[model samples]
Target chain A: MAAVDHDRAAQVGAQPLDVKAIRSDFPILDVEVNGRRLVYLDSASSSQKPRQVLDAMTRYYETTHANVHRGVYAIAEEATRQFEEARAKLARLVNARSAREIVFTKNVTEAINLVAHSWGRRNLTAGDAVLLTEMEHHANLVPWLMLAEERGIELRYIRLTADGQLDLSDLDRLVDGVKLVGVTCMSNVLGTINPVAELAEAAHSAGALFLADAAQYVPHLATDIQQLGCDFLGFTGHKMLGPTGIGCLWAREDLLEEMPPFLGGGEMISDVRLDGFLPADVPWKFEAGTPPIAEAIGLGAAVDYLTGLGMDAVRRHEVELTSYALCKLAADHPDLVIYGPADPASRGGVISLALGDIHAHDLSQVLDTAGVCVRAGHHCAKPLMRHLGVTATARASFYVYNDESDVDALSEALAEARKFFG
Target chain B: MPGLEDLYREIILDHYRNPRNRGELECPPAHRYEGFNPLCGDEIVLYLDVRDEKVVDLKIAGQGCSISQSSASMMSSAVKGKTLDEARALLRAFKAMMSIHEARLDAEDRELGANGQGADGEEAPPMGDLEALQGVVKFPVRIKCATLAWNTLAQGLDGANGSAGPS
Candidate 1:
């Protein structure tokens, strides 16, 4: 599919998205919530799957349903081909060095856990520091914390500035002796995009590996893993218009070859002797049990759908939408406090805001009445939540399907919430 | 499918706006217990003063949604002067009310041969303003918020009784 026209986009910093056409692909978008049109602003949590993805999974099940890599039958071979084909599509999506570098896990949480268990256990020891940022989702932080507790490894964090961007001023000092640096490319709560390339450079200069938690990045922006220069990257499918139960971890092929297998099971083993077992090759070694075959096929279809929409266009639409939302909320509700970089260009579509003295849960409840779906609470970033001096924030995130009207709806709902609570 | 009015009753909002017994009590005389709704980061700290087998006084210290905050406020007012046995009875009644829909859900799931138990029958005691929170039953996700303070209070009472020995 051709990319969105860049010449027109350059003039306004964004191409106008075909939002009506995009909304038509998602059947759930047509459903009414609370007798109102569903204004889905929770894509940052998990994106709504399109008909393309759903139909792809249904088609695969109807014709190609069989266990992969084990059976020699025709249907089994066809299933294996489709499964591996999905891996190649995912690899192309992120511009990974090779398809072998992509290891399928349950979700981003499992992907991070794979690294913490395999690479972390082999390399980290007592007092060996693994640096991370404070704005990471619990998916990124907890795995390292668990490794730190078990292996006596020290964990360090890159601080967040008052405006919610990562404070990399102390990067040189913090990464001095770190063995690995794990950072999110985007803050799931604050919508602040971190300088991944620069952080990767600092980690490499300090003889440490860098891992990019791209759960929020890959779904919204055009991702080029080579440009990002991270040794390991993790992201989930569910948050990227794909099915749940599938995620990808793209590591350098050499690194995956060196790291031990994450889980011990049938598919991951080459031969299971009475005394010991030989692990399978890199990607397959990481995938132990029966994979989510349908989910993988659905994810491939999701990739095709996004590639057709063009990630640049997707990013542009969100940037424009985010800017509109910021201005609209600020002009309408002076009491609304938005967390993250003030400039919309410096962030993704996530907009976490707090109204005057109102709890996030209460605000979200009121918004639900208006059929505006926003996520409320810590947003899996409790430490960042503490740093912001707020217990929780009602977050309304945008995607390709969202537009200025959605922002207007959110503004109107906020007004209702204020009147209801005030 | 229930409306906002079902989840946020006027009485609940009033309790949230002007929370009764909102603060911390002295630790020496008060037994403290904390509860957390990990799902939403809602925390409730209960400071209970149980003396001579009665809830002599109590205070709440924490922040959360209206359901949790107001539920905690009403809970403080309800059990402030009640005997330990009476307070336990109220806790049982309140929990039963809150779990009514959850129990029905479990029953439905069980009919599909899922692993779930049916709701046990329990007589409900008279609950005054606390009844306003019955609306929370319609919103399953917020039920934990409504019950946070009560759970914390139960823990504090259990600790007090354990420390006081057969009180």
Candidate 2:
């Protein structure tokens, strides 16, 4: 199961990941920029796609390209089979109960908006509440805000502790009237790996539904919806070495069945009468119009590639690398202020840093000149930035393909940038 | 290395470390406007006090990167006592210099010398210390940081003119 217990994996003593072979699979690592080898540390923004995923997409377009589900011809049947097979792959990766529970959208943002519109609009009323956290990305926050504005619902927030973890001391009071609790399984900016199971339990005890934004979590960790026990999970493919324009939203079968269709269009409809129309079945009801067919197949190939390497090994590698980075950065750059948990075990590989008196923009530019790509901005979480008392920070995230050498390059670049600025 | 040195010249850092013409001018008479670089969240507020068609005073207040803050500081000094038309001309010259062509700028710098005066006494370059920002053209992303103040000043000048023709 993707969401297998972490304690179990730790007990077994996870093996070191083979990053040398993994780097061979991603051709972009070979490119040079600004007379230096590309040291891509911006995986949190988007991971580079591997050859397997790219080949799958190209193969689909080259041979098996057709409009799925509608045509009964040979090529059409093949296309539909490939598309549904990809859905099943995703379901397996996330330990979803069935492929029918998965709704494909443009990206995680659209998936969240789908749930907010289809379920939130139907279930929520004035004076009802939606509970979110301070660390949620704009994708998770804005949709619920829009719904609240239109439906006159109240919105509550779970605050963050000084150390960047969620402060849940007041959870019982905050969840009193909340109809739904939407939160990120991992903080994209802070790199805090939230306890999704605990949150789900809290939401369930309060008689509320829980939606986990797994955009950052699913890529770096093994995820199982059943074990996590969340009612809804949304994640994007691009952040996990798959192509862009494809994302997944998994919901419990019964909840999806009861929800109204999100968009009125060709694929999501069973019958169209001038007076009224019949919506399609559970997953298709949310998937409107022609979908990203090739991209979906690419995502399936990405799942296969990740599964081949094993998610447990991947997580172990990231944890080890993150620990190394935290130590290396702190020892070398004492003046740098790092955001998020001090203990690497409580976070993913994402690390956001505020260097002494230097703007994140300038730091990123200096890093770029040395071919070290790092993201420097609000990271789409302006509220979190405000909470941290800073406008922006330089973030360098790692992935399965990244090793300690990458961290060394990042540290070296930071030293160079500091000297250059001074 | 040479490119970096050109972009972060000592004078620009001096202005960034010690800005000039910063703070508020008594308004109701002083026209003010604000601008922001949405890409990087850089902001600038420009203040212009015009008396008899000339910019009698200029001030800036904002926080941003070295490029933006230093550019604003230099811009305030450059246009403090110029006429509205001359200030707009300086803005145009600054923007033109910030545009592409790094090699040409280097050549222009060598040909015109440090004083920015042509050997043949044609016309002095409009931008003074603001010319140090010409190296910003190398970085496509930082161009907005260098131009936030000028754009705000332009808007302030427009407001000042529209109200009572520089009262």
Candidate 3:
């Protein structure tokens, strides 16, 4: 199969990326969906776990089923080692300076909230503004909106260009008065990949903190927090072919030290007092409760799996798949109208479309009937939908496991539906 | 054996292709109702040209799936020339039939089943022309797809959010 440039996968000012063998790692692609062979294309929402990841979790629960950091028992020690090992894996995945900078949360949503509650509360003044984007997922958007309102800070959005790319013209304008710049690395709806490094540089130049919602980007790309120069990066394990209930936030060492702890508990406090109690250092201070130990272990396995396949390879595969999907959807289904960047060279692997006169929900049903699983709705980007002049879009987001044949099945099913309706 | 295919039979396809009563009421004083199914985001704009509480003509104009478009076409033809009370009763009957799939409709029993056209074959509820929508039951996700228009009609007659233009 010929590999071509994907719209979102084309990284400006970045090195060459690879893809292909990564698809072999995920075993769920061999299964069936709706009584037909599965083509898991919804990786933008959540990715399917590989056999290695699943086995790692099962091995943890089966062989080393014990609590971490507290138990004096041998199994407890093993659990603690494995848990820390997962942290080490995550730290390495993002090239963090230390594992201590990684605080495990439930998902990226919780991680963002941790920043908003503690960092925003500490840094924001009454008139300070937080710069965001209109294309941000609710997880990335709502937290800042709420925190801004509560702290008397104004929330400003950087609009997207007509082609769905970030409108960089207002970068200085929006970054000027803003104290924080929170943007998505990749859009779930439009598949527009933001240039995180450039945005981070702009944020720092303006003396504003930059945070990346790496949920949609991290799984496919090799992420380096130090290289990107981002102040903070948040992502979930589930979206990266790992277990749910495990997420991570990597904050700069100095930022983590300066910001107040998100939650205080036994693990997060070294000493307590009646009037004054000092919180423990960086990661511990943010993680207050018994985290998802098994999930963290599974995430370690997932990182290992992705690393084995290589992030470059994953990105390349997705680029090829998205490009193929765009061409197939256009050529095969003439009635279909794909949203976002017209060329696959401009967007992520997410293929969002409206098929003729069919409502997105109805199209989703018809596709489901033919065992083509896709997501249809406002996709949590309601404001973006209003901007796009459509109610909802049928999205088929590809990952490592999907291939050209999956796009064929999707195209065939869509054609069947259009013919049936017509 | 009349199956799901029969629901999407030639007649239903004909109605879907060339929908009847599909326009705005011309120079008329009548209430218009619009309904939307947010789950799938299907919208139906139903115009009721009423004369002294009687629906002299009912018009619907919108684009949606076959279920929605067909239902809109069905609703238009079903309610035309019917009194407000009769229309409401018919709507209530259709709603009941939609919710309770097993219980046969009195409408069907009075129309063809009792009139000696069909017997042993249980009469699928004649939800006016909406009987074609029975295939929607198999696809539970699309049940709302078929009911978008009827739900709007229900909201309008109940006197709520209607007569306003769609945002």
Best by lDDT: 1
**Native contacts recovered by candidate 3, as a share?**
0.44
lDDT of 2 by residue, B1-167 (tens): 33677788899989998999989887758877889876666778877899887899988987788899999999988888998777766765675576463233355544654444333323555566877887887777788889889889878778767865434
For residues A214-277, what per-residue lDDT tens digits would candidate 1 score against the true structure?
A: 9998998878888888999999999999999999999999999999999999899999989999
* Candidate 2 lDDT over residue span A1-422, tens digit each: 22337635833766777899899999999999888999999999999999999999999999989999899898899999999999999999999989998999888999899999999989999999999999999999999899888999999999999999999999999988689999998999999988889888889999999999999998888888988989999999999999999999999999999999988888999899999999989789888899999999999999999888887778888888999999999999999899999987778899999889899998998888889999998899988988998877899999998999999999999998899876
Q: Please write out the lDDT profile of model 1 over residues B15-89, one tens digit for every residue.
A: 999999999999878878899999889999999988988899999998998999999999999999998877876
lDDT of 3 by residue, A60-88 (tens): 99999887888999999999999999999
- Given candidate 1, what's the lDDT at residue A267? 97
Candidate 3 — what's its lDDT? Answer: 0.77
**Candidates sorted on DockQ, descending:** 1, 2, 3
| TM-score for predicted model 2 compared with the true structure | 0.92
Which stretches of model 3 miss by more than 4 angstroms? Answer: A1-27, A148-152, A263-280, A342-346, B1-38, B41-126, B146-167
Identify the runs in model 2 with alpha carbons over 4 angstroms from their true place: A1-4, A7-13, B26-32, B51-53, B98-125, B165-167
DockQ-derived CAPRI band for the predicted complex in model 2: acceptable
- DockQ of every candidate structure: 0.69, 0.38, 0.26
Model 1 lDDT on a 0 to 1 scale: 0.89
The Cα error of candidate 2 at residue A32, in Å, is 0.8
